[model samples]
Target: MFNTVLVANRGEIAVRVIRSLRALGIRSVAVYSDADADARHVREADTAVRLGPAEAAKSYLSIPAIVAAAKETGAQAVHPGYGFLAENTAFARACAEAGLVFIGPPPEAIDKMGDKIRAKATVSAAGVPVVPGASDVDIPEGGFAEAAAKVGYPLLLKPSAGGGGKGMRLVHQESELDAAVESARREAKSSFGDDTLLMERFVTTPRHIEIQVLADTHGTVLHLGERECSLQRRHQKIIEEAPSVLLDEATRAKMGAAAAEAARSVGYVGAGTVEFIMSAHNPDEFFFMEMNTRLQVEHPVTEMVTGLDLVSWQVRVAAGEPLGLTQEDVRLDGHAVEARVYAEDPARGFIPTGGTVLAVHEPSGDGVRVDSWMSVGAVVGSNYDPMLAKVIAHGPDRASALQKLDRALADTALLGLGTNIDFLRGLLADEDVRAGKLDTELVDRRLSELISSEVPAGFFVAAAMDRLISLQPTGTVVDPWDIPSGWRLSGPGGITFRLRTGENQAVVRVEGTPSDASVQVDDAEPVRVSARREGDLLEVRRANGVERYRCADGPQRTVWLAREGKSFAFADQEFTLSSRGEAAGAGPVKSPMPGTVLVVKAAEGDVVSAGTPLLVVEAMKMEHTVTAPIDGVVTELSVRVGQQVALDETLAVVSAAEEKQ
Candidate 1:
């Protein structure tokens, strides 16, 4: 094993690699940007090196700087833990030139598989099935329409050198083709510095299955089985599991053998994933999608079933050790499921959210594991991906594992920002999902059903009780009359407090003192309830049962109450919450999340209708269009292209036609 290894990544992946290195008694070095100075990964490493600014280009993606950091820290090996420069052939070659071992496939393998266009051609020539797609050559003037004639409509335009769903778009019609191609190319150039693209026939109903392969210097390659990654949103995998229920024993062996053959064809080494899109309607047929040349984000699911330490093996193989296991030796034991916990709102198109993490409680049990770097007071910004952690569950059978995963998701709680936990819970509870009838479009097809709009009655009750409990005095009170809530003789019939979430508001009434109160939540029958604070927990007693809520109160009267695996935030009206999105008519269009303005589609005084694109803002490595909410005229344009804007900052202002009149 190497004496020291540098983790060329950030956030949870860095922490994960550092943990593995520590287990091997190998010193770990972590590299961070300014945004991650106090990050958990930095704190966990034996030594840390500072990259440049928070921008990924100047920091994590800067190959030269990472190589220099490795050399300076005396790291003998560099582990590119997915994302950033993980699949960059140049980075791997640069590390080799710097005399540092790159803990991944050789540069030749990366060059062949990293480029989607080349990977398809090479794999197809090697007798592996691939998706039908046009190459990365420049499109002729009428080439798109011609290409559509052969490949058919509903094709996918993807950046040849991109992953994680960046710079990819699906076009359903000829009218959408041009714009999709232009946008895909632009995002490709911005993200990967390559404007090259490949057009592929988009699979309508496919199950995304990836085979985890490990190779060594001695050309020993083995497949550790398949993971079902069909639960996706915006082409990004959200839920993944090992030993997919779709594949039979014979089909599993065939797919695994094909994946291993693809690896051997590219002379692959270390940890890599061979991704395939299988027809849900026809489980026997499969097509190669792409190969990720590094450790995957959802590798823990494979780990749980195979009982293999993939990271340690990555290190061992990089140190020129042969893989001890052969094809016959590999076995899949229990079923494992993993859900990605992201800082995003499922109801709002899964747009990235950023804020301080007030509190976090991860699920724990015999079959559950949470891989995370989130901590109280940790700042989640839009500089990178919104994924915060991954919660995984394993059991002897698929049904037991599915149930365990559902329970695990319900037990996990994170506060202080919007998340997709509730959305994931809905997925786990879906009839089709529980039945193992899954495909890539499962979430998107029933997005409305999966998204939650109904707020629980318990949420309001918890909020009202938290407000009353917060009014209690912190110091010792000698007399009962000294308690907070202004207990009076006969005046003040009820203490009314207003609470709002988005457009919904409730006027809660508490008829008695803080300790004992009759709470009427928005004209519902008054319930006799008692509120008491026991340390960080709030106990609320009602007619039927007593509910305990985990509450965290931050400065400015912001309270987060968590119960039954879901968290709700309540702020005292005195401290108004600013709107991060569009306001009412004629108001300013604010930047929803902190990001750089990518394009200004509308100029000042331009007349536009509702849903017309006003500008594009890139954040969390995704582009979101800010459109005109009402038919109006653009009046104030405050931001320029490439300008960095803060959350809720005015990007532009549109005056409604009626308001202007």
Candidate 2:
């Protein structure tokens, strides 16, 4: 085993790799950009190195900087943990040229498997069934239309150079072909520096399953079973599980064999994943999608089921060790499930959110594991991926695993930012999901029912009581006129608070002190309410029952409360008003989230109809298009392409059309 290994990544993956390195008694070196100077991974590693500025192109993705850091730190091996440079063939070759071991596959294997077009051909030649598709190279000039037609409708356009649902589009008809192709090409070029594309037949009812394979320098390859990654949003996997309930033992053996063959065909070594698109209706049929040339985001579930440390094995293999076990020696112990916790708001179309983490409560106990990089005061920005942590649970059976996962999510509390925790719990509780009737489209189909946009009344009551407590005098002597205890000579006295969350606003009224008060929320019947602050937790008692909430005070008089996996930030209405105190109207086009304007579709003074795309704002690799709210002329365009914007900042003004004389 190598004495020192450089982790060429950031966030939770980096932290996870460092953990395994520590377990194996190896000194781990962590690399960070300017944005991650005080990040959790940096604090955990044995040694830290600064790459460059926050911009990924100048830092995390800088091959020379990473190689130099590894050499300077005397790291004999470099582990590209999942994202930035994990699958880059050039990065692999760079490490080799620098005389440092790359703890992954050889450059030739990575080059062959990194490109989806070449991977498909290679796997097919190895007798692994592949999806029917056509790449740009497979067709003659001006033959894209003809090739697409032959592949049939509802086809998928995927970037040949990269994966992760980036630069992918689904065309259901010929009318949408041109626009889809153009958008796919643009995104592909932006994400992978390649505009090459491939077309594939879209499976109507698809279940994404991938086989985890490990190979050694001695040419021994083994499969670690499959993971069900069907629960997805925006074509990205949000929930994943090992030992899929959809596959029987017979089918599992076949898929595992095929995955092993695919790896062998490419001379693959170290850890890799062979992804397959299996039809939900026809369980026996499966098609090869592509092969990831490095460790996967969902590798934890596989590790839980197989009882193997994939990272440790990757290191041993990179050290030219022979296989220590055969295929028959592997075992699937129990079911395991993983839910990705991202800094995103599911209620707002899953847009990426950013803020300072005021508090965090990760779940623990039996059969539970949390890989997280979150810490109090950690600043989450739009410069990197929005994922903050992963909550995984293991159990004797699938039902118990799912139940444990839901309970674990309910115990999670991340304050001062919007997250998908509540949404994940709701998804796990869905009837169809619990029954294992899963498909790639299940989340999309049940999204409306799973998302809860309405703020619970208890939150408002808690906020009111918290405010009432803060207003109490803290000195030994208090002035009568300075007291805000809602005490008066009249029959009844009350104090009202106007709180706003997102676009929704509510007025909460409180009478008396925090220990005993009558609270009314937005014209609702008054209810007896009392609350006490205990450290970061607020215990509130109401007519129904007692509820505990993790609470935190944020900047600009924002009160954050979290309970049962749900988090809400309520800003004081008085402080939320604009400088002029003018009410917002439909004319202002505001950015939905903080990001950079990727494209300006409409110019100033241009007449546009309602729903016309005016600009595209991208953050954390996700793009959200801002559109005209009404039929009007763009009288004021405040933003241009590549300009950074904040949430709710006006990008343009669309004045309503003037009436004719």
Candidate 3:
């Protein structure tokens, strides 16, 4: 066992690895970038070191800096936690050259599986059925069209050197082949520094299933069943589960054997996973997608369902250990589901959200666990992936696990950032998702309908009422402006507040004393509310739910607290009232979420009809287009190409057009 292990990553995964190391009596060291100075992972480690700036290239991805940190901290081993330099063959070899153990497979395994084209060839050579595609490694640009045609029109162009849906494109017809290739090449270059691509048959309505394999240096390898990663958005997984609900005993056995074969063929050691694209209609039939030579991001689900800690096994295997349990000894119990909570918005193209975390109150209950790397004041930086946390729930069966997940999400409270908590709560109750009849493209098709699903109106009403009840200065007595001598005013006297947080805003009016208040969001309706200030706490109710807020001597701030599942936020000076006192919200057009604009779909003086795409914004690994509100000329364009914009900053303004014939 290593006396000290250095983690070469950041965020939740690093924290997760550290916890497992502590369990095995190993000291842990953490390295951080400028943006991650205050991150939870840094604070949790036994020792820490600086890596550099917020950009990954200058910090986490810097091989020399990480090696130096490990050596300086007296770390005997380096654990690349799933990303960054985890599968970089050069990094693994360099660690060994520096006389530090790399707690994963040998560099040979990494080199074999690092390239998608080579991985497919190797797995197929090992008798595993890989997806049929071109054998060419680097086909010329002009030759790409011919190869894609040979593979059939509806095919996929994927990067040659890695996975994660990066640099991947689908073309349905021959006419679209060249364009998809160009885009794929650009994306490949930007993401992995490699523009080489290969064509493959596109899997339709596929379910991503992976087998977790653990091997030791003593020539022992074992499989831990399968995980269903079918629920995805833009090729990124949102939800993953173990012991795939659709897999029968026979199919499970076959896939497990195949996964084991792949591992043994490569002489794989430590924790690894073999990913496959299974058909939704027939889960038994699957094709080899790729093999990951390091710990996977979605490994926690398998851990929860299998009653095993993969990280512990990885450490044990790397230390010249043997597999204690045989394949027959492995048993998977109750169903487990993991929902990846991200600092993103589902309503507007799932763009990344970066802001100060004002407050957090996570839910605690049976069969629920949360893995996060955020604190109340931590900033969601642009230096890494925007995942907030991974919430996992285990139950006796699928239905029970799902129900527990819903309850857990309901109790989660994270304030001061735009997250998908509310969106997740609604998804758990969705009929198609509950029935398990979904595919990779499900979210894309059902996104609008899912966001439009009604959130508990009471939660919103209570939040508004709480703001009205708690926004008073200290040592101020009520009823000072009464007309009669020391008289109390008759009827309810309310004050309206315009509260805006990015693209979403609220207009709230509250009146009367803290004991009894009337709250209204708009003139259309008025809600009778009761507020009570007990000591330093204030609780108000205008509807079915009650909101509690703590008052402090500071500028006007709205503290948004949600139960565990719903994403919430709080703001102080950034949320300012408009000139006319209306909320600082805009019209039908929406701006990017702190992202760089790639293309302006509509230009100034360009006459456009309603619903025309106005601009295209790329942020946080996804692309979204803003559209025209009504038929009108693109007037007063304030933004140009290659410009960055905040969440609600007006990118453009449109003039209402004359009626069309």
Most accurate candidate by lDDT: 2
**Angstrom error at residue 214, model 2:** 0.8
Flag the better candidate by lDDT, 2 or 3: 2
Q: Which ten residues in a row have the lowest lDDT in candidate 3?
A: 479-488
Cα miss at 51, model 1 (Å)?
1.1
TM-score of each: 0.96, 0.97, 0.88
Off by over 4 Å in 3: 135-138, 453-460, 476-492, 499-507, 532-539, 542-556, 561-564, 567-591, 597-618, 621-645, 649-661
After superposition, which runs of candidate 1 have C-alpha atoms over 4 Å from their true positions?
477-482, 489-493, 574-586
Query: Which has the greatest TM-score?
Result: 2
Q: How many backbone clashes does candidate 2 have?
A: 0
lDDT tens string, model 1, 246-317?
A: 999999999999999999999999999999998899988999999999999999999999999999999999
In the range 1-661, model 2's lDDT, one tens digit per residue, is 7999999999999999999999999999999999999999999999999999998999999999999999999999999999788999999999999999999999999999999999999989889999998999898888999999999999999999978888888899999899788778888887788989999999989999999999999979999999999999988899999989999999999999999999999899999999999889999999999999999999999999999999889988999998789999999999999999999989889999999999999999999999999999898888888999999999999999999999999999989889999999999999999999999999889989999888888888888888888888878998866668645677447789999877678999888778888899988999998899977899999778999999999998888999999889988886444546332354578889988999999998898888898998988877887889877788889988899998889999987767210
Model 1 C-alpha lDDT versus the unseen true structure: 0.87
